[model samples]
Target chain A: MTEGVVVVGLNHRTAPVEARERLAVPPDGLEDAVRAVLALEGVREAVVVATCNRVELYAAGAEAESLAGELRRHMHARGGSGVTLYEHRGEAAVQHAFRVCASLDSLVVGEPQILGQVKEAVAAARSAGALRGRLGRVMARAFQTAKRVRTETGIAEGQVSVASVAVDLARGIFGDLMGRKVLVVGAGKMALGAARTLARAGASLLIANRSFDRAEALAREYGATAHPLTDLGMLLQHVDVAVCSTGASGYLLTRHDVATVMKARRGRGLFLIDIAVPRNVEPAAGDLDSVFLYNVDDLERAVAEGGRGRSVATIEAERVIAEELSAFRAEELAQRSAGPTIVALRRRFQEVAAAELERSLSGKLRHLPEGDRAAVEAMLDALTNKLLHAPTVALKTAAANPDGDDVMRAARSLFALDAEPADPRGEVTRMRVQGEMTAKAKAGNGR
Target chain B: MLVGFLAAAALLYLIATVLMLTYLVGVASTLPSRRAATVSLGAAMVAHVTHDILRWVTLGRGPFAGIHEGLSTLALLVAGVAFALRLLGRRLETLGVFVAPLTLLMLLASQGVDAQPAAPLSGALLGVHVGSTILGTAAFTVAFALAAAYLVQEREVRQKRLRGMFQRLPPLEVLDVASFRSIALGLPALTLGLVTGLSAGLQEVGRGIPIVSWRHYLALGVWAVFAAVLALRLLAGWRGHRAAIGTIVGYASAVMVLVGYFVRGARL
Candidate 1:
């Protein structure tokens, strides 16, 4: 779990929306809210991601339990009073952040807005001076992982609603509905939604209905041309897509009427979306060449199929997240162990280089001039840095692996920088090196 | 050196076809396999073009004077056109799945045929005659591939089976329009090809060479089928499934004409 990271929050799954809305902090109040949370005892750094569906607080401290407790108490005092608070410690907390940024933890799994919300949260915390070190890196990496999930999988590929499916179907039939004619056969609520979506896609909207006044009302609202139901045939001949969401008892568009329109248009494809309970378009009309007629049942079936596809893509995204998480952990471990080993190895090389130089100066090179002696000492220090360069880099890479302890131990033994207490003579070498460093600092000051 | 280039091109086309199939069948990831297949196919086309040029230089004539050379030229044209469309910003790389296999089969078939060059052409006119005919056939080949994709995609949408390869295929409208445009381009080229071909045959007859009646009839029949497909679309508003089927039939007829030439002993 990497020791001290923690998350305490309540979400759609843990508590009802009523409880969630109570604790939901708006964007303007987010910085102040996160600052208050940071003021709590044991919470070192805090980022509060407050969205409509979730309110999660991510914090890091010396102890996870104390951090979670402080954050949870502060949260309860400020409006989390009745809701159940959930907590995840250390590595699980990081994983939760990853999932939230990836949108896998959203109320609607794979919805894209959560990523932006988390980015905003991180920004708020950073401006509040609450983001530092591991938590900041984790948030940045979380964004990259989320981007990978988006591009590498089809998690956001299909439409899940009947109204949106109508748009998808039309786009499938006539790509880039720009300036294409769209005829909404009824002014029902569902038809209004379908028409609004199509109009946004740049289609020229036409609303036709049995009640000309109702059609005109919807047409005025949507910036579309209004037509009486009697003109449906004329509209069908020119319109590329027809959304049928009427309250008709029998078929609003039968096989014969569509076939006649298809001929009148001279073989151009016709996409008819019949989102009605009684099924407005005749099911057999879909069989005609270039005619795609989808009723409410078909659209719902497509939604269900899209859900299945989303699930599969979600599984693929999770695998990518898991792989990235493991990589992060290994690298984090390596980073933690590598820093001290690098310092000790460089110190050891310097110590040995200094000791040998002293022996040479006293025993054989005693007659060398003062200037020549200083040159030899400077060259020896440079050689020590150059000699330890490769091992220092390698130890950092080798040591944080799940099975990296052997490499760390081997490095310690090879350099005589043991975890065990050093002998009296070894202590003498370390003190001599420290004193030499202090003298070099004074010598630079004198120059 | 010529054989080496041909073998490499064949292998690359095989790789691209296999990679595309894996992606379409959902056995592989999307971007990697698609990118690999595109690279492999692009390399194959380069090799195929190199081999065609080398043969042309060695023989001191056009490449399409025999079945092997003619089919090789056709394969290059099909892959080159489809690849060119992708480079031009048309999102039709998925069509490479069909293009690669067809190109590979043609290249392999070309290798299988006897490598016998025809008598050197008398003039530029005959070269134009042969080149236009092959060019028209290549456009038809591309149209045929689009038609096949359209039919598969149409079946999926019509049957409400929107999973697997259904998601991978281009929209039905895209396939339909691309296939139509190919034919719209093909018909004029085929018309010129027929005219030049007839003129050349007439010259051959004047030189006391026996005229092949069945070859002329097969060429005319392929032209008629393609012509009908276009006429039906323009006049009767026929598109989608029927238009796709019609284009496929036209391609089949065109292939039969090629078979007529191939069976007549590499006189293409």
Candidate 2:
């Protein structure tokens, strides 16, 4: 049988966030979910990659169709309704895994968080004892491929998030952000995210909110100081970048306030990131000298343009994924054939040992007690196991190399193990061609 | 032998300029090392100083005597000021992408000046006049580089295309402050230099020699432009792109005054 990967998942494109949440595996529940999936029939290895926008189970096994059904039942018991489940097997599954790890399949393609989430999923499965062998190797290689894609292609080019784009705009206006002071007008999510990005870039953060306690709470989280809303004017004068995402009915910062601040600032450039829905900063404030104001719409336009630029690099990104998938498939094929070859070789050794033990038990050991005869049989079995240990390890090691099939062929012919049943998928024949071509290429290159 | 040193300095300046340009364009995956660029530029300055001293010794005159010496001295002063500003902070180092090429051009132009027999010694007034003006022009050159960078970076912000070159430049505040400080120092030097030149011209006229030329008037015009920029900035708070463009115009006039010497084929 051909061993392949199977992915059964539901993402933002296939289901709404509400539906995804119903199937999402919480951090505390991840190990249990992975263990449950591994207990199912036909799932040789399992990893549950669950996030806010997606819930997916990836497995490596002989049967994709049945394994997907088993995963679907697991997902069904978890309370997802009206959600479309996507099932990808073999090459499609491998391709899907690569694309997801590379962030090409994210809701916002080219976003970088998915790769880290995938790593976390793999770690959880490993701790849960559900990740092993072929699946583990494939996932580890997928992480490397993701990193290569990020470095070699523009897949991760530009800031795609509104918060990050705001920070980028601030840098453009301020050059280096180190030691620059930033003022947050509210403690809302968008404002906080933008502030965090700026703070990470070395800008000092000052949080100002309507509620003093709320501002203090967020300030402690970011290791920043909190100020009252009334201090906005003083803060604006001292800050290089100010982000406003207040939940107010009117503008939090008006043209007159910024004009006064600019005079105090001596016309130093002030970047204002207004991410609120109703717009916190006054539009006319941007008209003031040395004030660069970008509302949510402007940030979205930048994000959209950046997305379009990244789409241009998709062809190259897809080519990278294709190369990684081919390597993974070849390795899987070799491992599959090597596994059966090891089993057949062990069986052949056991048959000869058992035959020799049977003759001794019936003739020479006939006078011995029943307990001694059983002990002799156990010794023969142990000897057979001990003899196969080095060869088993050698065969697996050879399978990882280019000429692994030669070793398999020699062992089969030498032990007459070919008469025994082996892998039903015909991987032996595929590996034969692959190994011979590789060896031939190496020989030709040497000459 | 002096030409060989000049060639080495020019080559080093060219490399530094190329590295800075590459950094501005964001073509390199990693940032080009600042230490390498700084070392290259510093070595270039040392060689240029060596070339100037050697030429001074060989010619047995001051480095400001002829068009050749004037150009070389001007290049050295401009590059030295730029290097000093860079040592103050890295934000000004990007200005080298503009300053280094201009320095190389001046050095190259110096080679084109014809060697001539030394004239009779000039008065102390003439020495004071020429030295102060050269120093003032060097300060103006540094100001001009900062202004150009400010305009480029400011345009990127206004257009909201914050990538590549925009990302490499100093902040608008930093550029604006540096430009103003340069003009603040340069305007006084230039004013003093112009006054000395006027005094020198009066002395030459007393001796019945014509010393007032278009270059003198152009130098006065350059002073007037910077004076107006400084005056308006102090009076009206003119501090951004408009101020930058004004400084650039002033620097342009100063450069034209230098070019006037080469065009007239006269000794300074």
Which candidate ranks first by TM-score, i.e. highest?
A: 1
Candidate 2 chain A: worst 10 consecutive residues by lDDT? Answer: A438-447
Encode model 2's per-residue lDDT on A94-124: one tens digit a residue: 6788899988776456767778878988998
Residue A161, model 2, lDDT? 55
**Clash pairs, model 1 backbone:** A266-B237, A267-B237, A334-A400
lDDT of 1 by residue, A1-447 (tens): 245788999876686545665776767888998899889888778899987567889988777778888888887987647769999887788888988898787644566767888999999999999987778888888999999988888776732434567777777667788998889988655667777888888898999989999989988999999999999988899999888867565788889998898889887888888765445788889888889877655664676577632578789889989988887776766665565667667767777788899899998999999999999999998888888888987787786565566786787788767643233456634554564465344324322
lDDT of 2 at A155: 71
Give the Cα error of residue B111 in candidate 1, in Å: 4.2
Instruction: Give the docking tier of candidate 1.
Output: acceptable
RMSD of each: 21.7, 13.5
> Per model, how many backbone clashes are there?
3, 2
True contacts kept of 1: 0.61
